[model samples]
Target: MAKIPKVPKTVLPKPPRQAVPPPPPYVPLRARPVRPQRTNLPNQQSPPHPSAQETPIAPPGTTRSDRLKQVWDERPRVSDIKRLTPEQLSAPTHQNRMNKWRQWTLFICGMSAFGMGLYGMQIYVSLTTAPDENAVPDDLSDRFDKEADGYDEKVSMAETMLFLNSRRKALMQKVRGHVLEVAVGTGRNTPYYPTKQCATVTLLDSSAPMLEVAKRKWKETHMEYFSRVFFKHQSAVDPITPPYGAQDGYDTVVQTMGLCSTNEPVKLLHSLEAATKEEDGQILLLEHGKSHYEWLNSFLDRTAPNHALTHGCWWNKDIGKIVEESGLEVVDMKRYNFGTTWWVELKPRKGMRKQLEDAAKEEVEVAVQKSWSWWSFWR
Candidate 1:
């Protein structure tokens, strides 16, 4: 083991050096020939092919004519562009624009109509349920006064003013001696009264609050005529008997937008006739009546029960017949707004001054006639 370890101390052979290849030599580029300068002319242009000097020469045995022929066959030729007809050019744009405008207009009109219909429906619902004496308690008078004071703010006062103004002059001229204004709400028409021509006006209303408001307004505005104006808180049916007294009967009784809500229009008319001096007194009425148009009448008839329930007013009362049956003569009846309303002037017939007394006496006769008719029917 000792002799083998001593023999291993030998030197290794040295490694050989590797050779690296040298980089290729750089050559200087030859200068190219300069092309002739071009003139700044609009019609002048260079050919699309390369110059002869810049092109490579073909090797021996190559055909140059075949390449030139192939290039010529591949070129595009110039041709005229076709034009559109005059009608075709103009029609499409104009028609498309018009159609778009028409569609927009129709859409806007339909929206407007729908909005108007909704507004009308709301108004119908509101007016049909408007409070009146027959339906509401006595406390409603205060509510009505509060409501009416704010009517302009709640509703369109401009339209209401215009409608009231239209009737002002007419009503003022028609008033005469012992004039009574029935259901004079807030007295919008009070300013229009002819104080000088009319001897006295008894403003009658069932609503004490409304009467109070009317009196206050009258005193505030026409304090001078306060003595001539009398405000009575009473129902329309409270019999024109003593204490109230019918000694000096009314000469002209006027009602505007009042009769429609009267609980018993016929009875009221008869009572009015009883309260008036024969032939001298008159009843002037301006009322919106049942429409004469078939469709409108049908609609009104259908809705009348609901209207009456809400408004405390009847829409289909035969007012003309009521006046006639009350022994009053219709002096004039004029239809307005396509027979949707009437301006009626009536008076007690001559010799019918004692109509109430006569009616009282004839009660037995009417009863006897009814009894006879019933007996005859059975026979």
Candidate 2:
């Protein structure tokens, strides 16, 4: 509604045009289509395609050779590539005669070593076999006493087969504080005992002759370790009570390859449990029995008679089953060498003594409450 004013317009200059690039020259399936010469045959007149005359111009910064390679790669099948022959494809990269000979030589050496080991084991097992059943420790003791000097050597011969020394070493290394080695035959386990960490050791045995050899073994190597070492004349089934006082029960009880021949193995186990401190005392055992494999078990069964008779070892004893029946809490149990060999650690059950007493009392009560009856026939 008020006065309207006219505004002046300013114009800007347009930019100048430069030369435009031409479209890239036509490219064919092949880099070069054959061109016809002036004197060529009648139908091939002066190259049929006008593109032949077109002369390709490569993009800036690229040579004609690079353009040629791009077209070449686009082709589905490359005519210039060489194919492999069947003979070359089948040839192994590492099939020299020297390699073949080396492989065969290694195989032969391995088999020879295996055969030699087997031969040595057969001789060793035969030598360690006891001459009679271990019905009496005195009988076994008498035999062992005569062989005491040669005993260590005989066992050494079977180390690889039976793993006797290794098992003893492992069992003894674990024992500490006041310790007990029951059925401490020849003191074979003393060599590995952790006596430096322990206060005292009590070596107990029923067989006097075996004790004598064990005593000699102690005097030889372990003489300086113990503050006090007692040699007790006792059986495996006997309780660790009386004269020694606090040293009677132990922190660890070690038994290796010894329980397999006892007259009453489970009874011995019960007695061993009672002899240890009920709160924390442990038992370490490495024992063998019938192998799980049918063939091996059968062989053991066949050999068990003469084996027990001569070696005083019952080869077919099921050590695992016996330990379970012994009422000790097996904290850890491992089997090796075809389920025949067992490495077990057991602790005293919380109320073992009470359980045995209760069982006995129940048995007596049942016997007294019994009502006699000649039984009526199927009425």
Best by the lDDT measure: 2
Q: How many backbone clashes does candidate 1 have?
A: 0
The TM-scores, one per candidate, come to: 0.54, 0.58
User: Model 1, residue 278: displacement in angstroms?
Assistant: 1.6
Which lDDT tens digits does candidate 1 get at residues 251-278?
8778765666675677677766666767
lDDT of 1: 0.64
Q: Candidate 1, TM-score vs. the true structure?
A: 0.54
Model 2 / residue 274 / CA error / Å: 0.8
lDDT of 2 at 328: 86
Stretches of candidate 2 off by over 4 Å are 1-141, 242-248, 353-379
Clashing pairs in 2: 130-310, 130-311, 131-309, 131-310, 132-309, 132-310, 133-309
The regions of model 1 sitting more than 4 angstroms off are 1-119, 123-164, 241-246, 357-379
Query: What's each prediction's clash count?
Result: 0, 7
- What TM-score does candidate 2 get on C-alpha atoms? 0.58
